[model samples]
Target: MTDTMNAVAYSHALPIDDPTSLEDVTLPVPAVGPHDLLVKVVAVSVNPADVKVRSDMDPDGVPTVLGFDAAGTVAAVGSDVTLYAVGDEVYYAGAMGRSGSNAELQAVDERIVGTKPKSATFAEAAALPLTTLTAWEGLFDKLKLTAESMGTLLVVGGAGGVGSMIIQLLKARTPGIRIVASAGREASQEWVRSLGADEVVRHGEHLTEDVKRVAPEGIDYIYSTNTVGQMDAYIEILNPFGEIVATDNPGLVDLGLFAGKSLSWHSELMFTRSVFTTADMVVQHELLTTVGEMMDAGTIRSTMTSAFSPLNAEQLRLAHASVETGRTLGKVVVTNEPLAS
Candidate 1:
C-alpha cells in the first residue's frame, strides 16, 4: 500500500456555506500506536459533532480530518494490540485528537473499538458507535438506570440519533420503566412511538405540563439529546431528586434551579475517556462489544435511516449539511463505495 491515501480535511473553521471549508486531499497513512489497529474504513457516519468541529476547531494552516463513527476491516495492528488481528471487522468512535475516519485508513486504539455486529452492514454498524456510547453512558454510567429501575424517563428531541438509540436501549434493557419522548412533528412523534416510547410530548408544548399529564408527578429522569437551549424546561419537569443528563452542551445553564429539587446534572461526552487516556478507557470497548452482541442477538436494532455513497468531499459536505439541520430521524451514513442507484 502507498504511504498516503485520499481524505477530506479542513484547514480553517469556515462555515459550511464556504466552498473550501472541507476539501479533498491526500494524507499519510497514520502510524499505528502500540495499542492501535489500522482500519481500512469501509463506512462512516456523520453526527452533530462533525458540524460543530468544522465550525469550532481552529486548524490554523494545518489540515485536520473530522469524523468519529467508523466501521471497517482491520488492515494492520500495532505490536502490542491483542483484541484484534488483521481482517477483523470492527467499529469504533475515533478519539478526539486523532486524524479521524474520513479517510481510506485510520489508526485507532484497540481498547475503544469493538467487533462489528454480524447482522449489520458496514454502513449500518458505522452509524452506531458514537451515538451508542453516548446513550449507553448517559443512561447506565451517569444515571445508573437499569431494567429494574422504577419511574419515567423523559427524552427531549426524541427523534434524533442519540435520542433514538436511548429509546431503543431503554426498551430493550429497561422494559419496566415508562418512557416519554418529546418531538414536534407528527412523523417524529410516530417515529418515537415505534421505537417504544410510552408517551409523546410535543416540543413546543410546555414540557412540565405535558409530562405531568402522563406521569402526574413529573418525570424521574430526563435525557436531553438536543435543543439543550431549553434546559430550564427539563429542570422544571424533573421530579425532586431526579437526575438529568445531556449530551449537548447546555450553554450557561443555571444550576441553582436544580438546587431546589436536589437534582443532579451530568454532562455525557463519550470521548472523555479516550481524550484523557483514563484508566477505565477499556470500558468503552467492553460496552461496545456488549452492544454488538445484543445486536446480533436481535435485542436492539440499527438506527441508520439515511445513507450516501462513495465517501468523498461532496458526499461528506452533504452529510454535514443534513446533520446541521438538526432534524435527522436517526443516523446518516456514508460508504466508501457507492450504493447501486
Candidate 2:
C-alpha cells in the first residue's frame, strides 16, 4: 500500500458558507497505536462536531481532516489490538484528538469500534456511530436509566440526529417508558412518531405547556439535543428530582435554577472514554457491539435519512451546511465511493 491517501481537510477555521473552507488534499495514512486498528473507510457521516471543529480550531498549517462517524473494513491492526482483525468490517465514532475518519484510511482504537451490522449498508452504518453513542450514553449512562425506571421522557428537538436515536433506543431498551417528543414542523412531528414516541408536541417558547398538554403530571426526564438556551423551559417541565441531560455545551448555564426541585443536570460527551483512555474504555466496545446486535436483530433501525457520494470537498461542504441548519430529520452521510457492497 502507498504511504499517502486521499482526504478532505481544512487548514484554517473558516465559515462553511465559504466553499474553500474544506478542500481535497493528500496526506499520509496515519500510523497505528498499540490499541488502534487501521481501517479503510467506506462511508462517513457529517455531524455538528465537524462544523464546530472547522470553525473554532485551526489546523496549524497542516490540513486537518474532520469527520467522526464511519463504517469501514479493517485493513491493518496495531500489535496489541485483539478486538478486531484485518478484513473485519467495523464501525465507530473515532477519537477527537487524532486525524479523523474523512480520509480513505483512519487509525482508531479497537476499544471504540464494533462489527458493522449485517443488516445495514455502509452509508447506513456510517450514520449511526456518533449519534448512537451520544444517545446511548445520554440515556442509560448519564441518566442512569433502566427498564425498571420507566417513566415519561421528554425529548427536546426530536427530529435531529441524536434525538432520533434517543427515541428509538428508548423504545427498544425500555418498552414501557412514555416518550413525548417536541417538534414544531409537520414532517418532524411525524418523523418522531414513526420512531416510537408516544406523543408529539410543538416546540415553542411554551414547551412546558406543550409537554403538560400530553403529560399532565410533568416529565420524569428531559433529553435536550438542541434548544439548550431554553433550559429554564425544560426545568419547568421536569418533575421534582428529575434529571436533565444534554449533548451540547449550552453557555453559562446555572444549575441553581433547578436546585429548588433537586433536579440533576448531566452532560454526556461520548468521547470521554476514548479521549482520556479511561480504565473502562472497553465499555464503548461493549456498547457498540450490543447496538450492532440490536440493529441486526431489527430491535433498532438505522436513522440515516440522506446520503451523498464521491467523498469530496464540495460534498462535505454540503453535508456540513445541512448539519448547521439544525433541521435535518435524521442523519446524513457521504461515501468514499459508491457503496458496492
Candidate 3:
C-alpha cells in the first residue's frame, strides 16, 4: 500500500568491494500490466546471473535492478490476470527484460509464477525458483530424459544450487537412475550425497576413474552445471547414445568428442522461454508447480542452506559476493525477516 518502496539498484557497474556498487534507493511502486501480478517481495535469492548483472552493467543503459528469484505475497493483479489474486503467496524467477524482484514490489507475468509450497517458508521458496527451473529444464527438456528411463546421471558441480536440485529431482522421480556427482571438497561431496547422489567424485581430479570406481561402465546422461570446457575429459565416459546438457557457456568447444560417440549435446538456458516468449512458455509454470508439489510431498527439499536477514544493499552485496566465489554449497537467500512458516 505504500506509494514508494526501497530498492537496491546501480546505474553503472562496480566491483563488489566498491561502496557504490549497490545503492539503496526509493522508487515509486510499479504498476502492474495486463497479465502481470504485482508482488510484495518478502525474500530474494542471489544467483550467478545477479552477480554478473551487478558487476557488468552497461554504462549507457538505464539503472538495472538485479534479482531473479523471489517469494512474496501478491499485492495486486492486472486486469487480465486470472491465475493469482491479492494476498496469494507465490514464488517465481522473474524475466530478464524487466525490473527484477530486488525492489520491495515487482510486476511479473503470472504465467511464470507458481503458488509457494505451504510447507516451505518464504526464504525456502525463494531459493527454489531459479535453480530449480534451470535444473528441471536441463534434465527433462534439454536432455529429454524421462522418469521411466533406467540409466546413470552424472552432475558436474554437484554442490551448487542447480546441481543439487537436479540430483534431488532425479532421485525422487526417476527410477533405476544412478546419480554420480562431482565435487572437490568434503563438505560439497557430503552435501550432494545427502541430496541423493548415489556417488560423489572430485571435479578437478580424474572423473573417469572416480565414476568407474562406482558404476564400472560409463554414464547415460550428463548435466554439467560447471563450465563446458571442464567437461571434455568426461565426454568419453558417456555411453554411446548418452546426452549431455550444460548451462555454462564455455566458448569454442570441439564437438568431435561427442560426435564420435554418437552422443547428443544440449545447452540449457532457463531464460530462453521468457526471453523469446516461446511456444512452450507455459511449461515453466507447469514445472514450477510440479516442483512445489514435490516439495509439499517431501520428495524434494529447498536448497536454501544460507540466509541473510533484512533485505538491503549490504546483505545483497554479501550474497552476491558469496555466489561469485562459485563455492557455495547451496542457494543463498536474503529476506526481510526470518521467514515465517
TM-score of each: 0.96, 0.96, 0.95
Q: List candidate 2 segments past 4 Å from native.
A: 337-341
The local distance difference test score of model 2 is 0.89
* lDDT, ranked from best to worst: 1, 2, 3
Candidate 2 lDDT over 1-341, as tens digits, reads 89999999998998897977999999998999899999999999998888889889997778889999999999999999989899999999999889888899999999999889999888989999988999999998888788877789999888988889999999998877899998988999899999999999877776877787999988999898775467878878889999989887788988789889999888889999988999999888889889999999998888888888878888888888888887788998998657554
Clashes of each: 0, 0, 0
Give me the candidate number with maximum lDDT: 1
Q: Which one wins by lDDT: 2 or 3?
A: 2
| Tens digit of per-residue lDDT, candidate 3, span 1-341 | 88888898877788887877877888888878998999999999998888887877655545567899999999999999888899999999999888988999999988889889999999999999988999988877777667777888899989998998999988887867889999988999889989999888878557878888886788888888776456666676788888888888877887786777888888998888889988878788888988999999999999999998889898888888888888898899999976445
Expressed as tens digits, the lDDT of each residue in 1-341 for candidate 1 is 78999999989998787878888999999998899999999999998889998999778979899899999999999999989999999999999878989999999999999999999999989999998999999999999988789899989889888998999899999988899999888988889999999999877547667777887878899888764567677777778899988887778877888899999989999999999999999999999999999999998888888899888888888888888987789899999756766
In model 3, the clashing pairs are none
